[model samples]
Target chain A: MTADRPRTSLLGTTALLFEAPGETTLETQRRIWAVAHEAAGFPGVREAVPGMNNLMLVFVEPPRRPEEIEQRLLELWNVVAPLPIAGRCIDLPVAYGGEAGPHMADVIEHTGMSVDEIVERHSAPTYIVFALGSHPGYCYLGGMDARIATPRRKVPVLKIPRGAVSIGGSQTGVSASDGPSGWNTIGSTQIAFFDVNRSPPALLQPGDSIRFKVARVLR
Target chain B: MIKILSVGALATVQDLGRTGGLSLGVGTSGAMDPLALAAGNILLRNQENTAAVEVPVFPFKVRFERSTVFAVTGADCAGRLDEAPVLPWWAHRAEAGQVLSLSHPKQTTWRATRAYLCIADGVDVPAVLGSRSTQLRGSFGGYEGRPLRDGDELPTGRSNGRAVPGFGLVPPGLALPLEADGVPAVRVLPAAEYDCFTNSSQDALWSTGWKITAQSDRYGYRLSGRELNPLRPLELRSHGIVPGVIQVPHGGQPIIQMRDAQPSGGYPKIGTVIEADLWRLGQAPIGSNVRFIRCSWDEALGASADIRRWLANSRRLVELHCGERGGR
Candidate 1:
């Protein structure tokens, strides 16, 4: 798919940012991945981190000639194609509402849907992983049905448990560890999002897809 | 090995941090003053990335379990070995059962809050995700995944007996200075959302004096300065962020993310402190004022090169001094 002109900016001396097209879109993210893949090959490149629609290039050794890197990135974006959605599919079993879902009532009140309807709507769509941020192994996902969309909590909770599935400002994510969050939680999964013992500790990666299954429900 | 007799506030094991893990939502949690960490390691002839005990709050006391060479870097904390005075930034040898103590720092040439206790061959800790630095939020890595406390025992990496005592190198802060128009300042490069801020906000960011607030820690520094208002209300998505990014939230005060900051944030980033200048920010004491100097990409890279040059020179000097002693 054709994308808008990729916007390039310097994060600092050691890091570079390339923003693709507009807002959160799969096409733009795919373009970002394409650029990220290409930028990773550049000299002095240390890490190529992808976001919702942006790619961050971190260099251990700052290139003496930065324009060369920028030019190369621009050139790559010109010939960019959608990166293949190639990753493992993971099934996340969620227990919706009650103690497991601390903020499920808030979500139901905001969406004005029956608890069962909300669960059906949430579990139906197979969300696409946009990026990982906020915490270790926390996946920022897209493709949530608009019917269940809810704004974030005004005052964030101090400590949300790990594996808590949440929604915040049109996006859905799972807590990687026990930490504070602003997202309204509706359910939680028992699976670990991060394990220090594992290689690439995060369970999900960009381009991976996740399907939520209702394991149980609590009133 | 060493046993903690008394842990003064916050003390954790840190190296250069886990760098390649940000993509997986893991933050780079390392030494706040990496220059000190590097210099301490160099004094002991240890690897640059070797883990060291980062002691922020002082009045700390530890007892060596065996004979070992060590160095204390960063703040001049008036350290002592069983009541005998030990110089800051100098390498020293201690015997088994000898206790080392550090008191409140006496700021002389540099205003630094943290001090690093570096032992030869680095601290003996299992590297988590390729680093020994403590990730406090996740509660893993370093010594038992937490700060050192009384009775905590820390092992030492095996040294090659090449480290020498009674020698020292100048602190990197004194060796490489960063200033702007006579004011100690850190260079900053504008970030992606720089233009979203108001003209006054930008001007104040560059021109005003920002006092590091008490709320500051390894996670970030909350600076009390001229209010930085954005041009409009921006609803930003959570995005990738690195340490040194200066972000402004609804309160108008700007916060500079530090080594332990989260990997991503939704705040509007006005500027990013140059990577080379981060050490200066790390040493800036709470309640102390600091200024921001706008610099170009090339200048920022040049600063990094300067740090490399400094490190290389220090390494060579230490090697020469230790080599002459013939592996004492």
Candidate 2:
């Protein structure tokens, strides 16, 4: 059964989440970005943020008529065509395995692949930035090689350091800052994905492409 | 100016918090008890979003470098200014060279864990991305983007000279109290994945009194109660979430996201503590039990309106009190 209807849910009284139904795809996320851009102009809307395939519209004030806003969002989503954002493609040097990747063995164990095989597969795709979330400057990238995909850890790590590259289920992303995470870390990077001093702060935005370069393989 | 004589951990400069940064993955890091911050600002006749010192850990002591008006609101820490008792939720004038000390929060009349120290104007911190709130994760706002330390001297903004001391307003927590069977309660609305949870788990969520575990902090509150099991193994794509989003991890326990919670999460959401009631949860002491009152979208909005009405009414009353004293 195809869950085709775009689902709208209240996030407390502050914001509303609009989730595009069906499989998570580039097409759906593009439309989400478009809707976000449009809904941001709505009265009382503070910020329109796009997630993987969802959009959350935070209000300046708790919306008096939420149903009206929801209806407007649905109308916008139906009509607003997919917007292709022109974003920069940045190549990041990644140090895979060894101490940098304490959970590489776990990923190998789960995926039934060697460390070399996993690294090759992980770095093969030119991933697109699906959305930015989780933490400051962190980007949720799409197009990870499904063969190396491993489920998130049953128990999340209390504190993963900044620049930790990890895989969670079918998705892969890097830790922009030191924080708790539930993903399986397979590598580490030295790039600062976020700098508050820097304009726009986050290194990547939705539609940006990332190519991981294997700097070294510490077996 | 005030010199931090002695300060406990996690006390930081905060305003209302930075917005429009969620798309960049920046979470809103502000006072845990925002009502206290706003009320303190109201007491001082300062801007509603004026930066204040959020003192969670106590026995905080500061020496006033200049005579300035200040107010201590939220959890009454038994404030004392140079041997003179300074009432909580009241604005007072501090003489130059006077030391203001705050002790452990008294849980006698009101149960709260955080306090806001609002100066006459505000804490003079360089605003980053439209706010002075210390974003601990990003480390780029407030005073040096870190918690206050001993010997740290925070500059206060130039006083508008309109502040009149000796006036106080009723604390919003006392005015707008929400409880379930005498236990401090927060209203919650069902989230996107509410139906995904088992019927028993959904029932348990409303009926059970969840204890705030020690792991609870500004980032999120780890609640311990009846395990919130889902109907099936549920996995969600990472989605944007605000403070109060209740995510049920695979472990079955629910975690209520707080002010410093990340912009997104993938855990199955059972319900969200309404934004209006987040301040109540924010002030809830660790190890304390809290009940969840299931509410509708309309009810949640109503609660938010109620808080706004309370703030406006309090502000009006404070203005009148200050105006009368100034006129005299």
Candidate 3:
């Protein structure tokens, strides 16, 4: 599907932003990826980073006129199609409940689903990786069952461990590193999300897919 | 080689920063005051991107294992080499086994924090992902991926012996002189979400002075100033953010992302402190109040050009000074 006219603006003197039409949807993200991939080849364009319903164009040789780049991006957005590519499937092992899932009880209280029911619903869908942001290798996944959605904690936890599988207001994903977070930690995973030594440090990419499997229950 | 005698609060080896990696979700981690790093390198006739020790805390002590020429730039932390006072921003040679101690930063001609200790050869830490800078968040790169501590021996690169002792260039702050409205301020360009805030919020951003809270660090500068209320409550999705983007969170206070900030954030960005003036903000001490001046796109780029011109001119003068045989 062709994208609507994006709201173009300068991110700063260095980069320009193009906000795609519609909310954070798979179609919008796919279109953003297509344009971002194409924009990378544009003159003076250093990197084109895809965000939730937006595309940030970082310039290496920041153009004399930023508006020119904005105009070009606007043109690309209106004409670019959803160029879908084959993505790899990776299963992440999770230990749910108890200490492993420190806030699993909170999810239960909010969703009104038993531990077994929540786990089954959450792990059933093959979630699409929409984007990576907030933290390194922190996947922004799509396809979570709305029934399992939970609001972010009022106060963020100071030091959440790496590979933390959590839910935050209609979204569920894994944390790549040990850092502060506001997501309700309902489970923990064993997958290594980031490693600097690796070519692509983040184990998951924008086009990848993820499935969660119940490894064991933590007491 | 250099042996860390007694490290105070924090000291880390830093270079220009790890760029071209934001796509991999890795933020650029590097020296806070990049101009200081570049100036120190120029004085020692070393590559501009050479790694140097960025000492934030005071009373830091170190002993050189071998005789080497070095330069200390940035803050005027009263420095001494084996009981003899060594002027900051000047290149000096230290004898083997001699100790170098940097005391608390004194309020001098310039009020600033953090100092750069640059050796003749760059710090010989193995570069991770094409950079020697320490990425604190990921726990990788630069001297075992951590801060320097007492008794830590760091390796140094091979020097070409072109560096001359007993001379230094003027501090870049004096030479470059970046300010707005006659006070210590940084120039800013309107960002993507500039129009999202209320008119009063926009007015306060350009007019009111913001104090740099003690909570500031390499990741970001948390500023305390007038509460910036948006036209309406706006919840933005996490997007790609660069250093110097002024993000206002729920508290209405602004936080300017720095070199080590995460690659992305969800806070509403009212403006971006231009890349040229980021060095000025880097030198701004905690508890200091700074103002922001709004500028057009061309003006922001012009500021960056001014920086490049200053660097080029400074390098030429230093080269000519070092080329002389009997230079003071």
Highest lDDT: give the candidate number.
2
Better of 2 and 3 by TM-score: 2
- In model 3, how large is the Cα lDDT of residue A12? 67
In the range B195-228, model 3's lDDT, one tens digit per residue, is 8888999999988889999978888888998998
DockQ, all models = 0.45, 0.72, 0.46
lDDT of 2 by residue, B1-328 (tens): 8899999999999998889899999889988988889988888888889999999998999998999999999998999998999999998999899999999999997999898999996899899988999998888898998999999999988996878898888787788888999899999999988998889999999988999999988899998999888887776778889999998888988899999999888888888999888899999999999999999878887898898899999888987887778632
Candidate 3 lDDT by residue in tens digits, A1-219: 113556877766767777876556788888989998999899998888887778788888558987888888888888899868568999988888888899988899998999888889888999988777766677888888879977666445667888889987677888888876667887888777788878678887888999999998764
C-alpha lDDT (0 to 100) for residue B98 of candidate 2: 96
Candidate 3: share of reference interface contacts reproduced: 0.46
Residue pairs with backbone atoms closer than 3 Å in model 3 (clashes): none
Leading candidate by DockQ: 2
Error of 2 at B237 (Å): 1.0
Higher-lDDT candidate of 1 and 3: 1
- How much of the true A–B contact set does each candidate keep? 0.55, 0.78, 0.46
lDDT of 1 at B225: 85
Interface RMSD of each: 3.1, 1.7, 3.1
